[model samples]
Target: MPHSQDTTPIVLTIAGSDSGGGAGIQADIKAISATGSYACSVITAITSQNTHGVSAIHPVPLEHIESQLDAVFSDLNIVAVKIGMLADADIIQLVARKLRQYTPKFLVIDPVMVATSGDLLLQQSAISTLKQELIPMADLLTPNLPEGAALVGKPVPQSEEEMGALIADLRALGAHSVLLKGGHLEQDANSNDLLIQPHSSELLRAKRHPTVNTHGTGCTLSSAIASYLAQGNRLHKAVYLGKQYISQAIAHADELSVGGGHGPVHHFFNGHVNVR
Candidate 1:
């Protein structure tokens, strides 16, 4: 049997590579595939990392990055793009330019700054460029509590009430929608994320899974959202579905023992049984 065409939704992920396989481009691909989307990637940087922390980062040259972007955008029928880590200002500007040129149907930006293991994946100087160039172009911006606070120059919200108070400021950053992750509020029993759009808001609540294997959670979540969007789900519904996916992934994290430190979520938790 000869197939004439493939109809799978193609989702592109532009991010750095995580040698650990728990986060960055690796995690994005896993999440997208697990969520039923074909995944493509363009690596901006590569990190020497593990479940413990990032040891070193080697950013790809700008021209090569541009070539990768052109190759993917020109060929693939990309429906949604999930952007993760860009190491510096130059990379951010180039990506922003390419995005303007190609303009995929849906764009999910995970403003990844600090990693779960307390490593700085993005440069402090690049923050301004990211804010000015990439953020406004996002169809959905997914930022953890610390990233949200950095975007708005405010303190990390201590409680849900404080998270509510920062919604207005977050919206002002110019993304069409924002998913403010509240997992950093470890004191809270529930992992709450606020979905703030132009005229409405919703609090997405999930049980906080008790485990240290939470590496790449943010990357997995944003990629899952992009995967859903590529599958033609509306933004609100896609976000909810993404939340559900991550929650389950977290719930099953303890099932894997990848490393000695913070480990990764089970991106394919629904697939095969983990035999001991």
Candidate 2:
């Protein structure tokens, strides 16, 4: 008997590889799958790292990167794309070109510059290339405090007021929408994110969880947003749902003792029951 055509939305994650399975393409795949979307990947680089820190990074060759992009975009009916760490200018430019050639319905760019361990994931020089080539093409750009500051060459927002003040600057970056994550505001009582669109802005608030297991948070949130978008949700709805999902993932993070350093949130927290 012939099987009926599958209708699952497919999401592509173009990011780097994390050996620890806590972030990057690993976390993106987990978040996408856990959120009811098919997961596919095109790795830009491979990092030797754990919860502790990134030790070494080996960028995938340009030709192979292009090949992977072609293979996936050509074969898969990708509804949305979530982009993460591009090691340098060349990779960033290549990806920008491919995106132009085969545009996805939704493009979420997580400007992953610095990692949770304080390691530099993207080169300082490539920041210009990222701004010029990829940011304007993004439907949604997700950046944490530090990454946002880097993008605009300003200090990280110290308070909600400061965060609000940067909205105009962030809006000038040319992305259709921007989610400025406030997780780095450790002094704050709540983890608030500013969602800046063309004509409107919204504040997404979540209770701050006192835990260090927030690895791959940006990747997870952006991937979840893309997943929801692929599943036919509006951009605002997808951002709201994605925020809710990550907040819960963070709330349940202490349940898993994955590593000694900053650990990962429980991507499938809703699936299992704690019997003990």
Candidate 3:
């Protein structure tokens, strides 16, 4: 569908499709729409995915992705862009170039690499393209602990302070601001997230209840942040409110069971009834 608006902030998601509807563009679209922003989409790839794992991946041709972007950019009041999975380096480069040419007000990236099922969705070479081309364009970049470790060429951090320093390092590397997700970090009982910017002393912190059904949390977060930013929240405030939304999302995850292993978070946790 082409991008359309009706006095709502229009947010676009450029990402892959999850057949299981837990992660990637599916989660992004739901999250953005739930946050009261109109959603426009440009899919980068399609994955034969399930709750257990990724069975296969078919990349959308670079030109096809570009055409989708063109369809949206030509006629929408696009306020923000959230990037998720780009299947390869070439696609990454193309997306980076197009985004630079048609700059949106807010550019938020969720650097999706390894899936919750332990499958690597991004190529080894594509990491370089992501770092070199994409991160520089982002107003905010969100990466999980494993992604952070890989991007910085270091071990997964054990301390919040270490994560803070790593966030700073990644900001220096490219992202104007960074949210280093602490999902993989184990602390007492709270799930934590740390947000910081280059040379900044202030640390933005958020917490959520620990839950088993936590799939799509990252995608949900980046999309939520983008939606909030599109609606005129400052970056840090957007992140903060996004955190609250995800916390409730996690807390209410078990209201509906969608999968056997690593079920999806309840995007309709705000009491919206599922129609289908």
For model 2, residues 1-276, the per-residue Cα lDDT tens digits are: 542234679999999999999999999999998898999999999999999999999999999999999999888888999999999999999999999999898999999999999999999999999999999999999999999999999998888898898899999999999999999999889999999999999999999999999999999999999999999999999999999999999998888888899999989899653513
Model 3 scores worst on lDDT over the 10 consecutive residues at 199-208
Residue 124, candidate 1: Cα error in Å is 1.3
lDDT of 1 at 239: 99
Give candidate 2 misplaced runs (Cα > 4 Å). Answer: 1-6, 272-276
Q: List residue ranges in candidate 1 displaced over 4 A.
A: 1-6, 272-276
C-alpha local distance difference test of each model = 0.95, 0.94, 0.87
Q: Is candidate 1 or candidate 3 better by TM-score?
A: 1
Displacement of the residue 68 alpha carbon in candidate 1, Å: 0.6
Candidate 2 or 3, higher TM-score?
A: 2
By lDDT: ranked, best first? 1, 2, 3
TM-score of each: 0.97, 0.96, 0.94
lDDT of 1 by residue, 113-231 (tens): 99998888888999999999999999999999999999999999999999999989999999999999999999999999999999998999999999999999999999999999999
After TM-score superposition, the amount by which residue 138's alpha carbon in candidate 3 deviates from its true location, in angstroms, is: 0.5
Candidate 3 lDDT: 0.87
RMSD of 1: 1.5
lDDT of 3 by residue, 1-276 (tens): 543464579999999999999999999999998988889999999999877889999999988999999999999989999999998999999999999889998999999999988899999999988999999888999999889888988888887767766755676668788888887865635567777666564545455566678878899999999999999999889999998898888888888778788888888887776734
TM-score of 3: 0.94
